[model samples]
Target: MVAQEQKSSHVFDLLVVGGGVNGAGIARDASGRGASVLLVEQDDLANYTSSSSTKLIHGGLRYLEYYEFRLVREALIERDRLLAIAPHIMWPLRFVLPHSKLVRPAWMLRAGLFLYDHLAPHMKLPKSRGIDLRNHSAGKPLKSEYSKAFVYSDGWVEDSRLVVLNAMDAAARGADIRVRTRLAAAKRVDGVWEAQIEDKRSGETSTVRARAVVNAAGPWVARLLSDELAVPHSKSVRLVKGSHIVVPRVFEGPQCYIFQNPDKRIVFAIPYERKFTLIGTTDEAWGEAPGRVEISPEEVSYLCESVNRYFEKPVSPSDVVWSYAGLRPLYDDAAANASAVTRDYVLDLDTTGGAPLLSIFGGKITTYRKLAEHAIEKLIPEMPVLAGQSWTADAALPGGDLGVGGFEAALKRLRDAAPFLSLTHAWRLTRAYGSRAYDVVGAAGTLEDMGENFGADLTAREVDYLIDNEWAVTAEDVLWRRSKLGLHMTQEQRTKVERYIADRQH
Candidate 1:
């Protein structure tokens, strides 16, 4: 971790629990405002829902039916802002919504598209338009029945990296970011929170004093409030399990597809990792206690079938290369169906005990910045020490500055500097690290200079960089979360990565 300016007593101005997008974002914004913040995470950053998203910074095109104009507008506005600041990890994606007469009529699709385009005038993406799928390249994979589609714009994101970049920026601004650490307990005392934080690696408990606390724990928000913090009112989260499957490139194209199911749900099939096509996201009602979520057999079948209704080539369970599941801790609106639940967030602030406690309920990735801004703004009155007026809107995240020439220009420059790197290898490094790719490949004159090959372009040098800089301690953190190289590597190669990380730490 980078060293920061520390208070002599170590009494922080803010103690943030959870290191997901919301918590990390809050830490970045709060710390930028000069708050001495300490953020604690039970596991790795974005280890759960934050990383396991459909990986889009979209305006919830489907939520228009549910009349969530406020969320969609906020998301649409924030989406452009994020794209402007982080072009390396974020870019524009055009979605093709094929006309399914049996599902929704063309008029409804057109109406929704019209509303979506006009809702946020600041949207830099082109407005929606009707397309002739019969002749377009995107239509080549679709069945003959789908002759038309509504093409609209949204942005794709590296979800896990987004969380990490936020945490990195926060740490750079003097916030202490502790991963693999759990918030054991806390109590209100003398207008401050006396919190017990335990480092999971060492199991050593330490007391942290903070004038204010923000509960941004995603799935465990309610449990932490009632159990650990012991000061709660009546806000809860409804766990909705969403799962996705990765398959070999289904078709060739940059444009993604949005399929409408018979059950009134929408499924997306996006181009992923240059070599594979990504399909997702079923909203299954979860009743069990929150834990590691996995895609059930039924869900895989459902996803395959959802796309089968439109695609020419059929996909089956055997074709799936990988699958993942995550729990969406939506605000408990008592909606009968999981899909009907609101994606909007609720921030509950309880100041009854003199010490302020703010709890965030439901949120999506697209608007995490705004959520953080609002969260910090609400606590500002109580935390007079925190200064600044919403500075994150104009700031660039760590490694986001790609200069005037932007991504393509930077890629060209990296390839020029590291002449030995293959086109694919250079692209991977640039996408993952942006301007910092040079640092990862520092002074490496050849492939051999990159150190030991852990298969699929993952070199020992890169692993060491992730460890020393990105807080990567395990192979899974490198292969799966840091980058999705695990999908392309063999079991033996993955084991090598595991052994290497173990040996390095030892």
Candidate 2:
């Protein structure tokens, strides 16, 4: 099971341990700056915390309550920047915060919305405004008592696709990406990082040398620093478990609802993937092992009750179509309340040891790009040859350059070229692949050319494309990470997919 080694002697300027959003983002930015980079992940890209997020590229309006104005402002700027670059996957989202006078006064809510509007004025996103809950379509699903609300602008991102597009861009820029490869250990040797990497799939291992190593392991950051690198852990990461649930689409309109709870932690009910509504997330201090973190019975009930209290249509366990849990690696601040802990990221670089191991802790998905830029800035004095000002600010992610704008037009073109594709199938492909939909459907005039049907809309050709290009190594990777087909596909279909992948290997 050894990884097909790319010549042992080929040295790298930077070695990144993790293929989550931050790691892939760092690799993309660093490699784009002309660094010889290598990014390794022990599992499929975005298969962990990155994919488990609430799936928004928001500025975190709630952070303002903790006097995190700076964090909120910076994230607001990033939200606008990401929308411009990855318009296909990232776009503007309007959040309606229905005011329940019992939870928080309307004046306090007004002040918050005022700051949210002016926080990042340089951005293209819309400003916040008061909404008459009874008149607005966004309030139709809400209970009658919630008669007033504030609507503010933020951004929504295809969380997992963001990681994939970043990794794809990094690879296209010449960075080496290794999936299912664990960073076993590392030591400074002759002023360079001599790291041992093991392939988790086949139990094969190899050693590599790099001038610098970045540990952006998210929830596993502390373990990577203390256990893998054998380095003294100076920074601590508090694992906060957040959970989300998907239910059959409940409300109409593109606007998402934000319920301000008495505990000060907000719950979001967002329009998701056309046919589903995404709601979440409960923030609780986690003392359990990181790997064992899952949505608890209490959390599920809390979320359902919170939503039911505000909405006309009550949400119960029976309405939940899917549920997911992710642990946020917050930089420990000794805050008594889990909700009060800062979500800001911190980078600790140990160049004093001759070789540098930069450990990243406590960042939100909204600010990963800026985090990557700041990270590379810290390494400039050490790796002087790594050139760059910042280029990612305006760059488009893979399949993101939808040149004109609407992906619907692109879908129309795809339909013209491949008339056999069903309307739903064409829409899915266009949204997923963007302009590259043509390459996927290339010369296939009929449904038969799509190769074997594995159930749902998944076809053999798409699976092969994921394996060859996206580093999809298993059926779960295809179903869960690469696509949400697992939600719709039956258990029998899932088994068939597993067999297809295994039989292909044989």
Candidate 3:
């Protein structure tokens, strides 16, 4: 039998590739400004790099030494902006950088902190200051050698959820979001992009047309340009593998610690999931294929040793419960090593053949919003003018209606209204869904009404909601990305969820 070809019914003004934070934010910004948008992803939203982040909305404090003052300043500004818009998924986090004269002298640390404090004058987080570890609460978890430290403020984010919320907002503002949909190929045809997109689930190929394409393909940015679109480009990304390990809680504190290594690199031990400490990230370079990314045994050992130097209790590879690694597609700035490579993004817009193709290179989670806004501005000339073109700078994402510092109030409201919910269950709902927790709760007056509870209070209702709304297609999507309940679920329970999603989809 001959194959049948399917075409998307409507042509979009902008076709965004990748469903990570940058692509989602671009879709949200463009669609909100009256541009018809279509965002396609090969897997679930944030299936890779976006979700495997340090999960901090920080200004890259260490970037100061590399003379990345401008990048740091821009990130700091966006960090504040993101906090106000999505306070539910983000919160204020203070970092304690233990001072070591051997690694970095006190004067050098103070000068760097001073620059960090004033780089963005409008920064809402508290200014950096020196502290006596002997008297500070953060000092209790440290070894005796660390006598002084510096405290500065940044924000923490539920990384993957932030990506989903952006995609949700874009969908709400009239963008078509297709997950588990891969863009196979595309070329300029008749002054637009005629592309082949495949449904990864059903193996069905379809065609979509768009006036412009945004290559937010993260690690695949360069390959997409040369192979898929067949567009010639001079810019490329340096894929650096960053790995993180989660161990049983290492310390008893809300604040986090940033440790200095003998090699002059820094490692962070962050309080995670209430019962574990999140430690990461090696600067090892990744030169292999894009899709397969994993933390090597060496990287794991490096991270453990990096943190053990300061913590009163030591951590080893055997103590790690879960570990993850992601590739950082840094714009290849011809830096000597991966550690010195710039973390700032560069938008390469080409209008060579007919339509516009915008390739995003090198960016962190803290700067995605600004990157999106900048992307749309660059493409505005290529696409039609949007009426009343207001940017997403001040817009609140879906369920972000709770004002700044209102997360606790929102949690209280959820508990009061849903008296049947355990505080832990209610807290998860509020943080993930925010003002929409009531929607997830639905009209259920009892826990049983929400249906079967497994893996520490994950209910049938919540899973259904994720399937129907958030484009969650698989069990891993629910257990790992949507929430970190996988860590709590037994292998048997996880299998049940996998079967449940499959059955529900059918």
Candidate 4:
């Protein structure tokens, strides 16, 4: 960590505001190119929109209909690159899209899949194909009327961990990362950006200087510009709330389903954490603050109804074990319907009177790396000291260097080396930390050496690693973001973990 005094005293090449995927990616990219960077987040990493995604590294299949060919093609290509870099956190998943003659015609579906397949022609993932649902394993859980389905491949991600990984890589590359630090104000002074940042935990405020600023505040982008920097941007963001619900496993297979709703939106039911089914996402206009966004009663009903349309068994609000909502800061294009808004990002570079401030509007996780590369390209003319060329394209994120052995082979090696660990526990560690799992499991020959088990295989040693390395302070950061142990733990167990974190802080 960069010392507080040093952070305030030194002038950085870039000051990245917001610790979501975009900001983290930019910090990592800039630091890799030899630019001095400091990134500040107002809350825990991925505590907002980044953690609340549907957890897919997918090319927006539906976006093709909106004529967003460029975005789809870019995302499709990125899917392969992400899979190669972080095989543990990201992998290919087959999506079962049941055909509804009453809705989209068979020809239209086929045409869309064909375009999707050819868009990224070199992608090694399986091509889309029609399946006989009556005889397929995916069919057994669906309604009897659905006899045919379309299966296509996309990627799933550990959403919050992805953000943490990028931040980790950035820090490793010499970028200063500060979580729970809020940007209070900024002004152009003597051809540089002078900013005041407040640490939310300690109530300490400090001033930092930077050659440039990046507003990757996700939902708070526009507000940060107007309120903190007092700069007006011609582009505005539309906050659309998307909600997801988790219930007990609804199907027997590993495959996920993409169901078409009567309202023309789609919802996904994916296998989650080996014990639950994840279903989601309703797009609705939101005017509320982005922090701590919650799923509405109506959204719960909407998700349940959407899944029930295809699944044999129905689910209701009572069946939902967990639900979360996030606000997407989409670039406002004056589209009439919330669902019609484009997912493409727009970068506004403000060099109005003095130092430059780059504001990012609307971006999905699938294309964050490319977005960062583009951001650096735009800033290079102003900041010529930024090293030549983009380097993140082939670089591996922290703990993602599994070599040619790959994730499965790495998992086998982990279990083999840690004979004392149960298969489930070892698997969990491998999935969460990749090659760095050994670092967490270090020298412990027995379960007793792991220290205080709060529940669901969560131990003190793992928590310490998160605290010391990943900037995890609260139990919620451990249970929810760094890992999903909360879903498996009881309230008493959670309370115990919370107390453990509190005790360690003292």
Candidate 5:
């Protein structure tokens, strides 16, 4: 039976299904445009593919080989735009691509770099240049055979935090964000969509009315369309599993490595969590449920072998401390190889017989903002009440208001305000929350005032903030998504956190 109290009588202009980057971004954009929006997620925000990305705001450099110039240029532009808007969570990083004669010739590498640089002329990042690995700092951990490299610029993002920030911004703009809520079914009712939503935790059902629906369900996009919405989509999504491994720091450098495999696939080795190196991801075809995806033993061995091929210190499966896998719901373009499939997104607007249903396919993290803008544009005819302009491009996500002085300035201000906080604690908070770090820290004047320490600088006060503001309900939500403190905490510490959150909920 439907819970009468949970039912929403008010009709939202748009109902965004999915709470990943794309969905959150769409809700933020649409709500900012004065459209009443309701966003529902089956799980915590960025609980899957969004958080499991390579975590780079980069143009798919390899896509240029496939002649995806438009996607590359758009991603390149978005990279800078993301950096400018969220300097605290997104910032510039230099990438070192060691030239392999066995993979590609120097001329081809140079040419690719040239195109990457010139693709977005207005980009503020430094241009790519050749470097002799023999004398460079980035070559210290590499084998002596790798004597030359090409360095270029890209941006790094706190992938999960980016999603949460967008949701927060949308909620602040009066959008209703419902997490742990599943979209059970939907049917067209007199030219409008009446969606049945279920609270996963309570087993309670409700109904919501909307003028339009956005299917940004990522891996579940195809299934949701066919099963729930009853919409026949001719276009299909190819689910490819990408896996990553986290190991002890491979090298002592700030630069990341883009290694080329003999199979023509590339793997990235990036510094992560300040103490570990992240290397991955293998592109293998997946046919299982997206949520059940996990890195296989073969994938671990492949990744270890991929890194061992270059580094002087061999990496084995034993060296891996953590590993994760996510399925990419790429648009099936009939490519012979999974890696050859286009990384660009495709939007299909269905306005045939009833209300509009926009299904998003094959989008990358680097271009989610643009994807949202385009999604809203497609719905403008259905929602003429929406503002005539796109405003998200110039707006900042929540906690990302760094002001004109940038990240360092924001960090300094946070440190000065909270003299009780240690340098490491203050820096982490500033990086994670930007100007809003003060909100989490609050009026605490001493360490004890921050409440229980669950290890690795994760205070109870921060946990409360996440629960009250960010919709974090469990220890996993706090440790993994709200922040990656799970990487730094022991099993005992994690259990304590779980117990604490459970007690609080009770």
Candidate 6:
């Protein structure tokens, strides 16, 4: 057993250093397994690479080419599990892939999709099917020259909300979640580890002692390993920068398009936030620091060109409403091409160095839960009394207890209770809050009871609930993570919210 280095007021079984999907998911899982957990984030939850992902809960069909069957199958299985558990936030979307004889032969696409269908346990999701693009609704917005299409199913997640929900769930299970609490330094004292946490807003510093520390800091994994843990290692992480563009919705229906580019890379044009089409992503090797990740004009042009090749409605730079870029903290496999770098995660457990420090290398949002399970399993040998069973796969998130009447039933309940609420507002409330929407809205019989309407589907009541419950410290945290109202809110509305938060700090 590791002896205590010094007396500390706050001591936990596990201390997680990142608030992205993996860190949040691990915190939630660890707390649920009866471990005292503390999760500290330098920024808001999902403020970094997690929110910047393409936001698909996919099995990685393309990974088939790399023969990553284990990863693909595990991810495929997790997709159905997440859909059943978080129906309000995640759902199945069909991707139409127009056949290009030059890129991939039809048979290869068919076989991959077939393996994806069979690899996972069949849930509510349907299998893939080949389609004649000329006759299908999916191809209505595609060029007439593309005749054949392959349609497959995968889950889509509201990326930031997913991170928030996981954090909320972890909090509910008694995890101490501290946002804007940056990890300044960590050192092993005797047999226990002590870490200094600095509150970004208060500018105050505190110390936390923990038996085990988890380095789940996404792109900053190596930095934490070297600078904080002071571990001497020579491992490098390949940072691949990916960018996405949001354009006006070109198709009439909910279907998304997957185009095969001449470079043998794929791009997705998904129906986003109802009125926008989300297209992405370019794989470029990034030497820039992770904190400086941003969309380049060249990458934006490449995305537009790729989409224009298959779709009837050609997109230009002017058509873009929003653009985002993130650095994928991939395991440095020394691959010749950036796109070919492995997406699978690697864990370096340093147990022999007085105290244990587990550093996570690479991972995706889709497989966060399973990754947490594996992480916990790795630590069990060190702490033999720890429980071995996994509990997250069947567990519901904070608001996920409501059965799969899907999002509609929750929305209907909200509307029926508050007859005065607008359809748009009610739907947004239900979708964002799930079964717990009423808990915040309360028995408000009228709009006045719900408090001030800030902007677009946002209200004072919701903002208050977020700050009180989800650790929303800033205006950007509220608009982006707790909700997507920032996209629809005007500058004046956002400024008002910012002012309100600033005033509250004093």
Off by over 4 Å in 2: 1-7
What is candidate 2's CA lDDT for residue 137? Answer: 88
Model 3 lDDT tens row, 60-107: 989999999889999989889999888889999989999887798889
What TM-score do all the candidates reach, one by one? 0.97, 0.97, 0.98, 0.98, 0.98, 0.96
Which stretches of candidate 1 lie above 4 Å from their native place? 1-8
How many Å off is the CA of 405 in candidate 5?
3.1
Better of 5 and 6 by lDDT: 5
Cα deviation of 109, candidate 1, in Å: 0.4
- lDDT at position 59, candidate 3: 92
lDDT by residue (tens digit), candidate 5, 1-506 = 44543677789999999999999999999988899999999999998889889999998899999999999999999999999888899988999999888999999999999999999868899999999999999999999999999999999999999999999999999999999999999988988899999998888988999999999999999999999999988998999999999999989978999999999999999999999999989999887777858899999999998988899999989989988888888988999888998888999999966799999999999999999999999888877967568998879887778876888888888888888888889899999998899999999989899999999999999999999999998999999888999999999999999999999999
Clashes (backbone N, CA, C under 3 Å), per candidate, total 0, 0, 0, 0, 0, 0
Please give, for residues 123-176, the per-residue lDDT of candidate 1 as tens digits: 689999998988888899999999999999999999999999899999999999
Model 4 global lDDT (CA atoms, 0 to 1):
0.92
Q: CA lDDT, every prediction?
A: 0.92, 0.87, 0.90, 0.92, 0.92, 0.85
Query: Total clashes, candidate 6?
Result: 0
Better of 3 and 5 by TM-score: 5
How well does candidate 6 match the true structure in TM-score terms? 0.96
Model 5 has an lDDT value of 0.92
Pairs with steric clashes in candidate 2: none
Q: Score residue 329 of candidate 4 by CA lDDT.
A: 91
lDDT of 6 by residue, 216-259 (tens): 99999998888877877667788899999888886788787788
